[model samples]
Target: MMMKNVSLLLFLIFATSLSFAQTDTLKVKTDTGNVKKDRKKVEFGPGKTHYAYAYFNFMFATPPEEGTDADIFYGKSHSISYGVRYRLKLAKFFAVGAGVNYTYYAWHFKQNDNKKIPTSIIYDKEKLKINALEADVFFRFNFGKNKKSPVGNYIDIGGYGDRNFSTKRQFTNYINDGNTTGYSDYTGINTGLNYMNDINYGAEFRAGYGSMLLFAKYRLSDMFTPEFKNEISSTELPRLMIGFEIGFHK
Candidate 1:
């Protein structure tokens, strides 16, 4: 009886030790840092991506209607853009960036009068210009790291707000009167910005190589909420822009 009792006690001790030694495979937690750090801290100096840049943009507007081409955003997108921004890299794959940007967009159009010159045609080629000052804020995602470049290859999503403070339309009529010989130029007329809305807010997306990107934007506000009468309807539509920009950016 004494030997059996001793044997039973030994067995219980062995079983308890084995239970404590066994590890649970399902529960695991890793400590990422030796100390706590603020994720919002700003970084600067060498190898940083804070920069001022200039890029030529080929930007175009989306047509308002599917079948009709007469839209506020019609024609070619010849634009000039410049900005300064600071990039805060929080991790290998994520960053937050904000900047101020200035952009100028110009478009060319022609209105023809068939009745003005039946034998030959007369048309007014008008140039429209809009100047905007904007602020851009975005989050950037880097797919991987590249030590060769200051700015990584990234995808950016952001919001932008701009004041289209100035607008003008200038046109010169060209008369191709085969009756009168060649062509004649008329005095140019300049129109004001009163027809356009003063403010615009939009969403933007960009993807590209380091320092160069393809970009697009959709404006949430209407281009014109008429303050005047026109030949057509008083309401103007919201707009979209698509462009490419090359940046000396971080």
Candidate 2:
């Protein structure tokens, strides 16, 4: 009986020790000082929960829409657009962001009509307008070991969709024969031809000064709309945008 009691007590002690020695799978709550010293591992917050930033940027445009045979006489030029981006980081270096952009330009056409000339056709534009809306989703890769500034120098690459919300095509005609009569036609080009989806890639440099922050990125992508091809010219595969990006996040 004594031996059996001793055996039972030993078994209980063994079981308790094993339970205490088991490795914990749950993350133990930690303060700043309790954080691991490794800098390679990405850390979201010492105790905080979220990260966000606001950015303002400008993009240079390139032609992605090519003109048909009727569009040869139509001339188009490069334009610039500006917008604001709101970013939310869901993980260490992954973020989802959105932006709104607007751009417009007018094209001028010139042609001569003469009875002496073999071709009596002319093409000209009185006014044209192009407007767009863009949204982006990107993943940011961070560099350096600064917690407050987790993003020292990083690359922001993602994909975006651009939609043309409004487009206007206008033309003016003058009658050279018979009675003195002239007319102008204003067409609302509501064709669904104002949408673009492309992959975006860019790099950013970040720095902080006192209370002000400085940041910049060089972004480039390909934007094309076939329905509005007559309104634009096709020259290249990708459009280039080089401008300063300024933003702050906490």
Candidate 3:
């Protein structure tokens, strides 16, 4: 009877150990399955993440076909714009974004004897510029087989509104006397100008490939107010802008 009782106790111990081993193996499998499910839920792709980017543009103006009052030096007149944009992907091929930028536009006038000069001021070198804050919203459409990144070919259509905070005119001229020759520089800045429009609106389009783009903008509103339209040669500045853009993304 003692031998039988010892054998029974040994059998009970072996059974308990086998049961615990099976329970541990099942727990491990269950945990691994959960991990895989979590990974599937968090996969990175288009329409799955928010994208942030920085962009810069080099711009040129297009004067009117008939005639323009502002005859600028094409090589010296340009625009500088830098801004941050926030994009929300709505679908695999579609997204929308908005941005705010600080933009500066400079137009250097030509002082040649043959060219018609602006009647507002006379100088050897003159520059008209404006400092503005711009806000824009756009829709983006992506193309190609890659959907895992936003750094692919795309097109954007947008509209922008600008608030011109500062308008400035800078003049430089060479002065000569019998004994000496010197340069004279004068700069005038005004936050509120009677001839300039404080608010402006425009339409913009962009075609991009791998973080680089070509853009064009057309101003629907005049740069000068109607009341002061005739003050500067009865004409307006250029209404079209063509440019290239570079985008920075992670």
Task: Provide backbone clash counts, one per model.
Answer: 1, 0, 0
- TM-score per candidate: 0.66, 0.40, 0.74
Better of 2 and 3 by TM-score: 3
What overall lDDT, based on C-alpha atoms, would model 3 receive against the true structure?
0.78
- Candidate maximizing TM-score: 3
Candidate 1 RMSD to the correct structure: 13.8
Question: What local distance difference test score does each model get?
Answer: 0.64, 0.43, 0.78
Which sections of candidate 2 miss by over 4 Å?
Answer: 1-49, 62-128, 145-151, 169-238, 248-250
Model 2, TM vs. native: 0.40
Which digits, one per residue and each the tens of the lDDT, describe model 3 over residues 107-196?
788765433333455677787788899999999988885354456778999999999999876667665544544544445443445677
By TM-score, highest first, what's the ranking? 3, 1, 2
Higher-scoring candidate on TM-score, 1 or 2: 1
lDDT per residue for candidate 1 within 1-250, as digits (tens), equals 9999999999999998777655332122112231222221333522443334454455676655322223332656356777776667777678788888788877654344322111113345566678889888999888876666677688999998998877876667777777656888775655556656778888999996776689898887766644432433443333677878777643
Model 3 TM-score is: 0.74
Error (Å) of candidate 2 at residue 94 is: 5.7
